[model samples]
Target: MEELSPTAERLVSEFVRTTRRQGAVPSRQVADRTLELLRQLVSEPGWRQTAQLVGQLRAAGRQLAAELPTQPAVGTLVCRLLKMAREEHGAHDEVHEARPHGAPPSQVDSLHRRLTAGRGAAPAADLSSELTGLRANLLAGLDELQTELDASADNIAREALSHIHADDVVLTAGRSATVLAFLRRAARERAFHVLVVEGAPFGGGHRAAAELAALPRRVHVTVIAESALFAMMARVNKVILGVHTVLADGGLRAPVGTQALALAARFHSVPVIVCAPSYKLSPQFHRGDQQEGFLESVSPESVLPYADGALVGRARLTCPLFDYVPPELVTLFVTHTGGTSPWYVYRLLNEYYDQQDHEIVQV
Candidate 1:
């Protein structure tokens, strides 16, 4: 097992403590912090090879994942950084090695080929000499990733006009910063009505409605109870929501009641569009048997107040913070890059993450 440096360990520990104290930190904020930590780790002295840096990052990622099991963004960002480091190293090695001028570019082998290939010890190399310019390349890659993260909301907002149009009644639940940006951008040109289902216990939808109503542009906003979601679905033209994490199998781990909202949209034949960034794409699969760790339970006091003494002592209350919506219920995912169907999530995962590093945090 590899160990984390003193700086890395201290940073990881502080992050865990902060997140624990202040629950439900936004995924984007978590990703930004994680990226900065990785930048510091890369710039730290004494790393002679890419492999050493990768090992330290893996260790730090596992620590974060263990301490903050609910925050998948931490693991996702770590996996991306690992891939970037490997690519930078590979690019350097390819530059040094000689190849035929007319040789075709190497093809990415399919999973079938990888499975059938014989397992053998990887060739060892003295990467210490090959470390020239690797740090600069990695820093550049990190800068590019940070830029992408920062611009994700704007990029997704740019496509709002294509999805939303004049006189369309948009239905949404919970308060998502990305969803708000999307709607606000569309309202600049097109006039539309927004129906917000008040997310119970938290009332995030009410906040969303208030914010939308306060916008300078004209946007009709209505706050409805969760019970009215199904009734209002028939009149809704589209359903747009934000996600907590996008699972590998194209499923959604979103705020509670999102599954019901998607079901209502599907019943009415309305499109369910999810506004999320690429960093929220998680490579982990959520299985029925793994609910113990994957599903988070917050305080039950919100649902069953302690003032109701008799019920509080006798009745059991489980306040799950999220719901899982399978791929079949989701129509499309609107990412920063562009729109993609649920079925193509695996390809995005392959592009953003390395296969071997997918389970780095799990280890």
Candidate 2:
């Protein structure tokens, strides 16, 4: 495998840093960036065989997955790239190996000329031609992946009308673009009340409430504190929340207060619906002890910035960026394709990731 150019290295580093600092970028954006990075990776200076390219892609994928183990999209995109390469290689083999996967050299080497002029002057034309076709097809496949990422939000939002009813109260937490888009889509045809839970410390819910209120629709928007979750449950017809990751065990890693919200909804028998892109569906099982490692922790100052330094220094505050919401608490998952039960997530995972790549970290 050839080394990546300086520009590609910088792009990868920037993505890693930005993702760590700002944990709320949409999963679709992350997937798109990952796909673009892979495209650049394959374009590096290398005129290798299809098998060699596939091996390099796998190695690069392992490195990228290590950079951000919690983001499942990185691994999913990598697997898709590998599948494309293998398919192209299979097609080339059927053509009697007459063409190589790499671009053919402008000048073909003759045996007598090769023996006299040395091997460095030219490359085999067949190998070069094959690579040209492989790169083009791989890029086209990447473009298709990007298109899917761009369309996911709208596709998922289209199903809002089917799940939401007129004059119902929809409660949600955090400033999730996915949830906001879903609600706004439904608002176009029906009027309802939306209660945004103030996810304290971050207060993302306040921002979400403000955005929802500003939408040009008759949907009533209300912002409430986390403490008021249970009290307001009776009034909420449904809980439509967004997630950071959906583990294969049918559990969700969501906003810090989402567990409480889901619990309240469960107690009241109100349906709890989760809105997320299919890319966020991870192939790993959720481990409680390891959840903290996967999730980001904000500064303690966000919760007690005004407190005395001495008191703040002496106390340990656990402010995790996300919380676990078990499958049982969730009634349904509304993804880009359509709505389904949480147990059905494994099937989606199978479609997106390879069986061997299920534990990407191990790879």
Candidate 3:
């Protein structure tokens, strides 16, 4: 794959983090909110967020499918919810009078025109320039979130280590919750030495490992087998993981091995923690109580050169890029907002929506 631009990568990473926090399920309110943020990144206003939201929506549909409930409740419920959100937040008829009912980029120019119609717009005032400056300010505010994430990362790491004695090790899943927070605090505390599990096909954990490595603090990376997780428990004192979704009830859907590791950690008296950004924490759950599966596949054609015997009867291979880790296995959720128990995710969602809904105003 071609390398992604830093900005684009950051956007995707943030999305990934958001999805983990929101849980695998997609809800209309959460989707609508996410769409708005993505819109800010593109020129088409809602168009970009619409496209970006599609991935999570599809994932939601798939999760709903997994429950296989004959009742069809998932479709009916979510559709109703989505329709309600659209009616409320989707799009509104513009007030042609233009005192500013809305000023999405698609309509900003028209609004600007209305403000200056037949009036020679101020020669020195550039509407686009003004918009650009405003957008910059908005982006700067969002960028400040990085500092919170940094702090959360270190805090989680420290908390994870709190129950741990020196020389004891910890292993975490692919970006389990609050890894960013732990790293942030870890860097600030001048922490050195971190071992990360490289999640394959994507190896997102490597991103954290790389960031940690760059912190002027010593950090290390080691790839381990999914099968060996339990066996290695003795050396690991804590397990830190990132999450994609945290349900209203506090259940989580993360990478596959996560649940197993959480169980193992509990068995071994190890604390399992999550690091996450605040944008994540939406109270949505996958359709049906069931978790979603990762769509993965291995190339059958790649082994063609080896012949049928070497190919071991010529079976195709498949791989999963993600997994659904349950919330009960987690001990704490480290977020920019603060450390929360799994159940607190619902409360976090309520608070986030309360703030987000009022954040954008016509004025």
Candidate 4:
């Protein structure tokens, strides 16, 4: 139940404020900021043990999730960091136990042992030095994590050519930087037609089309209405989209119109490809779970303008921000690590996260 440090408190407040006001912030940016803030928190000097640091991090994570319940990136990155700390601590312990008794730290072949050679039952006078070494290892691991985050988009984009082909028709809805980069990379070498469904309420598809049209490639872009998605599905060769989070069961929590689009693609026998980085993978299962904050709703003004007083007062408008696309609808998932089947998501989740920290943020 340790409280967050002053630095952690300030950073978390700023992130929550900016995210609440500008809901358009990309998940990648949110994740990067979250990781940076966590790195800063890990560097602050007052921790006596790994458990204390973990508690403070969990508190900051809960605070972020409470402020922005809809954004999964905040919680995902927090859990990942927690796992990293635990892994480093475990490695430290293993190395310490494996080393020869009375041997100098430098003689140990393991990098972790060489970093810190101290028993878990060390005297109080030596605990500070032990923690200091552990902190250095954790900071180094975070640096590597930051590098991975920065390169995730490009890594996923590299596989675009493998799926998209010359003269193929690609259908997508909404704006996803990962999806955009994937198409951009494919269009550079292959000539393809992109059909962008104008996802209403947000109209993110319009912006997607504009950016695709501007790409310096032989890519032909077309903007289609959401209502026409079903009619146009027959002609699409592949449906490439992006998601906000990949649930543990392999289902997707994607843009609002994604379910309809996936259904249409399935009916037409079109392959549906989802572009997402490994960080978007969550350990939480959405099926049959009564998690109150699982989904989010936005202002209905875009769907039903308040200016139309007659219908506004009579009709109850609900515009959900996301859609749930079951794993069956997804033919393939293109992640930073490469292509994976929807069924394989569970394996990736296991690799990226620890089971113990799955419910770190209860809300």
Higher-ranked by TM-score: 3 or 4: 4
**lDDT tens digits by residue: candidate 2, 118-206:** 55543322322254578888888889878887888899899999988999999988788889899999999999999988888778888
Off by over 4 Å in 2: 1-24, 90-132, 291-295, 361-363
Residue clash pairs of candidate 1: none
Q: Please, what are the lDDT tens digits per residue for candidate 3 over residues 1-363? A: 122334544554565556557643423244344444333343223222332323233333333333322212232323322322322222332432453555553355445656987887534211111122333333343344334434544544665434434444657655543565555554554444455666654566677666666665554556565677778876676776776545556666566566777788888888887765454443445444333323433454442534666665646564443455566677887665557898677656543432222211100
Q: What does candidate 2 score on TM?
A: 0.81
Backbone clashes (count) for model 2? 13
Worst 10 residues of 4 by lDDT: 120-129
RMSD of 1: 2.8
Q: Model 4, range 237-282, lDDT digits (tens) per residue?
A: 9999989888887898887888889999999999999998877887
What is the descending TM-score order? 1, 4, 2, 3
Instruction: Note the clash tally of each candidate.
Output: 0, 13, 35, 0
Q: What are the lDDT figures for the candidates, one per model?
A: 0.84, 0.75, 0.48, 0.81
- For candidate 2, give the lDDT of residue 163: 85
Best by TM-score: 1
- Assess candidate 3 and give its TM-score to the true structure: 0.50
Off by over 4 Å in 3: 1-168, 175-181, 187-193, 201-215, 219-223, 287-317, 354-363
lDDT of 1 by residue, 138-197 (tens): 888999999999999999999899999999999999899999999999999999999999
TM per model? 0.91, 0.81, 0.50, 0.87
